[model samples]
Target chain A: MKTVQNNTIRNGIKVALWEIRKLVWNKAFIISLLLTPVIWGLFMGLPRLFEKIGEPAAAPTTYIYIVDEIGIYESLSQKVSDIDNLFLRKHSGPIDDLRNRIEGDENAGYVHITEEIFETRLISVMTGTGDTHIPLAFNTRLKETLTRYELAMHNVEAGDIEKIVAGYFVSVSPVIEESVDPMDRVRKWVPPIFAMIIFFMVFMSGMTTMQSAISDKRDKMIEILLSSVSASSLMYGKIIGNFFAGLIQLAVYLIYALMFIHFLGIPGLGHIPVHQLLSYIISPELPLLLFFALAGYLLFSSIYAGLGATMEDVMNAGNFQGIIMLLPALSALFISPVIGNPEGIIAQIGSYIPFTASIVMILRITLIDLALIEIVIPVVILLASTMFMAKLAGKIFRTGMLMYGKEADPKEMWKWLRQ
Target chain B: METLLNIRNISKQFGKNTVVDQVSFDVHKGEILGVLGPNGAGKTTVIRSIMDIIRPDSGEIRFNFQDNNNFLSQIGYLPEERGLYRDSRVTDILLYLAQLKEYPRDRARKRVLEYLAKFDLENAGKMKIKELSRGMAQKVQFIGAILHEPAILILDEPFSGLDPVSQDVFSEEIRNLARNGVAVLFSSHQMNLVENLCDRIFMIHKGKKVLYDTLLRIKQDFGSFKCEIMSEENIRDKFINFKETEKIEQEGLRTTIYLKKGVEPGQFIQKLPDNISIEEVTIKRDSLHDIFVRTVTEN
Candidate 1:
């Protein structure tokens, strides 16, 4: 037989192709890939759907039966004449009988104006449907009429009563000094949002990478494969394969989101200039952000791949291994705090820590215009830590994959790492 | 004989426990070397070291070949802890494994079909591993190991989980591979099969080598004749004083006497006491199984 020797890089690529085929060709993964965006679209569109369903077909005239003990019924009836769908009617019967008459009718309501309302300041409007909200215009007119009558009872002049009940109002209007581009809003938030996208992508992809390692050990295929290739090659293959898989998943989700926004005519996203947004993505900062994202993925995935080898099964993973698996999620916990205070101490410290650096740096860059050094120092730190983690994980993986039947304790892993 | 792989004074330890201590053996082309040991006897550890799945602490494992970096691709390994990806098709898993050895895809596919037919699993290439029975899966794993036509084949307990008929098929194929100049390191608890199949035996106990010689020499050195005498009464005390008897086992009416090495059965029977109720007398040389059991217990 001719001797066939594959190089390390080629072997790693082969391993990666195997992992990619295993994940991408599976039915369950494909189903989940197509279903996720559909589910997200449903969640986003359900409220708008309900609002369209709940809107009234046409405005029906509402009969407001007033039991006025204060005897201002004729004036009140005349005051409500201009409202097209609302009419006031005087009622002399008992308040209980009037309430029973309008109990089940949504268009019918009763107003009980007792003398006690002047002291308590509570106006009770009982409608047939329990959830029928009184119109704000109607509520304001009733309050104005009641205040005018109450002021007249106190011997105030009719013309002065208008001045007494007419309280002050404030209006807010933005003064535009210059034209605002609609894409400006999209530009400001896209970087941090993209950072979060990277974080989520890493989280999902890291899990598959870890599970792949565990599956290799569980299936007893590690030794056989390792005989043909090195352990480092296998680790690299898993990380690279899952990386592309995650990107494919993210692309699919983004496509569905854009399609939903376009077809459904979601208001805010409709008028944004697509070309300008694309230009913003292609800016120089994108490569920097991508570097952070790639470094972060490498950092956490290596740890996960290493720790997975120490586990006999996912269900029986040790506490230490389980915690390492969740290391990517640590960046998620800092999202709220860092977004709230981009220049604060928490964000600054998070940008220097390897685990949280990628996400926090992305948040800081997007939320605020940062200095060049602010990005550079964190990038260097993240780059160094990523390299360190990959090396450590290689050591741990080489020995841990051979262990079986029981999980490797931290001490045992430490020994392997040391070696 | 041309030595394809050589292990020189290899030792491996786990924590403070020495699992393989100063073990040395050579796998020659066209020879089947049987690795015999009880459980925890370091046979798997040595095989793994040779395969480069694990490293020895203080010894050298050298593949005596031209290419060192790609030596592993030329060695096929079937580990004792054997399994395949359960959710994957048999053909895909085998192809992937063969490709790792740098086997061409077209040749791998052709070889996969050939092996499948040879193992009577012609219709199982499209099926997932979980769908196959235990014996079928074993056959698939065996095919995966040899699909690349490796120069050296390291099989750790290859006959495990196989029926007698399947075992015979595997045995014949292994012999064929050896006859085609493949060095086979076969480890198994089935001593009878090993005695029939292997050209040489390397026996170990408690992580140490106890016997390393040709099969004929091993038999001559340790395989003594055993005498079985059936009587009406217990004959346990009758052979206690006989110098020719190395060990005695009495079970109710039957007494088995293991004679000292090189002592003929006829020479020892002449000294048998007369008037003993000897209903039947039979003499036979010890099989490899008995020799293995005796060597393990003696140490």
Candidate 2:
């Protein structure tokens, strides 16, 4: 009996080796691996490239039509002559007509400095259609010129006027104590982020497992293969093969991510406490994250493999098959809610549901530290669910692999499961 | 000859349809057993049952070997639906198949090269399956089946789409394998090929075994002498009156007469009426194709 089991395992590994060889040596697979870094580089570099390309060649000049009722235009223009892209033109026409004429002109606008500035100490700048607000350079120059003129009229000293116009120095300091340490925040965030990575990796790898089964059926190699090895072996081999393949792909992405973080100096990443974060991630909590991720992957991938077998063609998949394939996506819906309040009712329920437990538990762990029992219950549930799913998937795979020409209906699958 | 494989009282049903019913057969070493059946006659189902791809409702498939470990490794199957990974190279796919049978990788590699060379596919090894012609692909698939040099070979419609020359090549290879002690179970619609190659024949119709016997014995039982005559005169009645004439068919200027078993052509010719004017005459035994159609239609 042990020998038979050994043979089965050996055969499964042989099948796995074949699958790995096919995927690793495939030209498309290799190209996609290489393309990940190139795509990441493009994603990171495209905006900066566009920014450089978008820099203004030569700023368009704006003509400031000065409607001066007070004799301050000459001095203001002289004071602002150093500013590029700004030209002041004294207008002798009716102010209302000038304003009306330049209303729609993007490059021209008028500023009226009347004696009302002395009474109300207010001056208004009417902009044209092109300008949404008064230009900062022109406004600063006008303020400086008016203050000096007013100081001269009032017999105030130039030093006092300069001090009055000078910008004030103000500093803000928080009075409350720091709530969360930056290191603690990084340490808290690493597990959930790692969980998210594992979840996506499992999703990608599970898809490949499905594709592997579909291709075996589509290419009509399933029977020949089954004659050499059992159908469960074939299904398990695909899951195991794609699992490693997905890890290799994830490793490639990680290398690119590490390069980006190390070189690009992402905000907060540079100031993050790496040693503390690494220690936290390498602890027993890491095993919990891995346990859920692995169990979740096995559960979904087995079902995906069976779903692929029942399909006649990937292009025209049945509605039942499509629904089964979307089973993993249900786990994603619990992400935000569980993260919102880790101790809330939703998180508690989600952590117990087999489909959503892996992700929800990971998110919950990051938000709030849980007791030992909190982790143990979900782990047990996931392990049991995974084992049961694997067995059921084996039955479906055995029958469905031989079912040619048309997709297998749910009723037929139910019959097979019962058998 | 030793019976390397025995299947007894096998039955299979699929939801109100009996695909195979009470089927039993034995495949002996160093011989070819041709499984003859029409469309949807459950030939594939029986073969799949023997391979353990599906379980028969009631049957025992026993392989008489000293040691029964990894019995599947000893069997090689060529399914009716022939396929390989389209994106995989010929050598790679062959090696993978051999490895699946638990054949050593290094030895499988060597066997792959030898088979490729033997099939005239040496130069095409590096090419992907999609790049090969249909015949070439079929040859590659055949080589994949026999790469491990299995003890039992099951080929289902192995020559469905092959050209005549390729068919001859495959036929010769199968004969060579059988001569070297491999038990081969072949299923095909090509009766003439089966008649020429198979030592024994198993015919099934509508999920039941209609006929099963050695080729020579079956011919002796069902295949009697047939006589054809071409004449301008009405000679059908003349041939129909003979005691040895079992049946007669008449066409324009032609007549075919099936003689009863143990009846001699010379005796029948001597018994012909002298008034009949015959332009041409020939006599031969019944062909397997005729017997197949007759048996199926009768059943």
Candidate 3:
């Protein structure tokens, strides 16, 4: 029988293809790919849909027994009928008849009006308290109608009140940002979303990479795999596979988000210029960002891979994985502080730390227009750390993947790392 | 009898505990080498080192062929701790494993079907591993190891978790592979199968090599000038005066006695009590199983 040998790069690619096959072939993953967009559409599109649908239908009509001895509610009745979400019908009947009608089902409630002989006044509106929702709407509108009538009696104008509430009369307006950059509003809101997207990409892809390593270890396939190629080649293959899988998820989510903005005209998303965001993405700054993102994924995932190789099962892997999860969690923690003070000392320090660089650097760039040198510092650090992690993972995981039977203690792992 | 694979004083240490001591052995083309050890005897460690899954601390493992890299594709290793994707189809899993070994995708796919057919698992190609019975999974895993038609096979506890019938099938296939000139080195705690299947044997205890020789030579080196005694009475007290009694294992009505060097089997019968009712007397040569026990115990 003839033996075949593939170059290291080709073997790594094959391993990557194998890793990717599991994800693409999985029913749950495919279903999630389709379901996520639908969810995003629903979340983002629902409000705009309501706005397009316009005013809602009016509420159910109520027959009011207007005991108008003093004739105060005549104008109130006209205004209540005009209200879009309410309807009113006046009843001109005796007090006994009004009470009976309210006791019966023909009327929702009744308004009784009477003036004391000494010039004091008394008014009462009665409705069944069995249901609150319908009654609350009915009561609020009826009360508002009476309030307008009282205001009219006192010579207060409704148009003037609206003008006052709209801040037209207020001389001062609050402003947050100093610069008058037209894209300031867009930049302000979009960065948190961008930072969160980076965190999600790094965390999820790192998990996939870790799980792949743990899987081979669990299946004893690494032993078989090592027979054909080096452990480093196998690791590179998995890392490459996970990178592509992450890219696919990112693309799908981005496309759905753009569609959410483009078609649904979601409020904040609609204001963002599509061409501008696209241009920024493809700009020269993109390669550096891409480098940071790739390196961050490798840095975190290699740590995960090393830990997972030493673990016996998914549960054990999760324990170490939870510790590794602190990278994104800590990045998320740093985000609020970094965004708050984009150019502050905390942000400056966080932007250079490899684990937090992917998140904090993106936040710093978008929140504040960082200098070119400042941006390059984090990118270079991330690049260097990524190379270091790749080497360390090769050193640690190769031996960890092969050791069996007993739990992987720290001392043994240290020895493996040293070796 | 050309040397197909060679190991030279290989050793591996995990932490401070040396799992595989300075061990050495050779596998010949068309030969079967049985690695025998009790539990935690570093059998799997030695096998893994030979496959280059784990690097040795102080020695080199070399194949007879010129291209050591090329020789890698010619090895089929079934680890002692074995599994396949429980949720994946049999065909996909096999194809993936073969492809990782540098087998051509199309050829691997086609060959796997033929292999499945040979194992009477044609219908199982579409089935997930979880759906297969224990024995069926064993057969499938065995097929995975040999699917690439590797020239050298290293199987660690290959008979484990198999039904008797599957074990028999594995034995036959292993012999068939050897006859077709595939060198086989398999480790097993099941001595009978190893005795019946392997041409030569390598035994280790506590990470140290105790014995390594041909099956006949191992038996010759540790002869059985021993007798099996069946009696209702305890035989330990009877052998107290017999200076030739090397070791005595007494359980219920059976007493197996191993005699020291130069002791005769007939001499054991003469030492027995005349008043006791003895049911049987059998004298025999040492088995590979016996040699394994003696080697481990004596060392």
Which candidate ranks first by TM-score, i.e. highest? 2
Deviation from native of the Cα of residue B148 in model 2, angstroms: 0.9
Worst 10 residues of 2 chain B by lDDT: B234-243
Query: DockQ-based ranking, best first?
Result: 2, 1, 3
TM-score (chain A only) of candidate 2: 0.76
Model 2 chain A scores worst on lDDT over the 10 consecutive residues at A271-280
Q: Choose the strongest candidate by DockQ.
A: 2
* Shift of residue A227 alpha carbon in model 1, Å: 2.1
Q: Write the per-residue lDDT of candidate 2 for residues A1-419, one digit (tens) a residue.
A: 89778877888888887888889988899999989788978977899899999986766678888888878888999999998888899988888889788888777778888877878978777777744434588888898899888887898888888887786989675788655556567666777687678778978889889889989988889999999998878988899999888888888877666566556645665733334445656755777788888888999999899888899776788888888788888887898888788888989999999999988887887777899899999999999999999999999999998888888999999999998
- Comparing to the true complex, what docking class would candidate 2 get? medium
What lDDT does each candidate get?
Answer: 0.87, 0.87, 0.76
**TM-score of candidate 3 to 2 decimals:** 0.77
Query: Estimated TM-score per prediction?
Result: 0.84, 0.85, 0.77
Q: Per-residue alpha-carbon lDDT of model 3 for B56-160, expressed as tens digits? A: 898879898756666677899887778787778999989988887767889898888888888889899999988999788878888889989888999988999
Query: What tens-digit string does per-residue lDDT give for candidate 1 at A1-419?
Result: 23222376788899889888988989999999999888877887799899999988767778888998999888888777788788788899988898889899888898899899999999988899976545677888898889988998899998898777877788665786544765677766666566568767977798889899999888888888887888888999999999888888888887775565456643766744445555656666777778888888899889888888888788998888778777767878888998789998989899999999988887787778898899889989998999999999999999889888889999998998777
- Candidates 2 and 3 compared: the better one by DockQ is 2
* Steric clash pairs (candidate 2): none
Q: How far off is model 2, as Cα RMSD?
A: 5.4
Q: After superposing candidate 1 on the true structure, give the runs of residues whose Cα lies further than 4 Å from its correct spot.
A: A1-6, A50-59, A63-134, A138-179, A271-277, B228-242, B251-255, B265-284
> Interface RMSD (Å), each candidate?
2.8, 0.9, 3.2
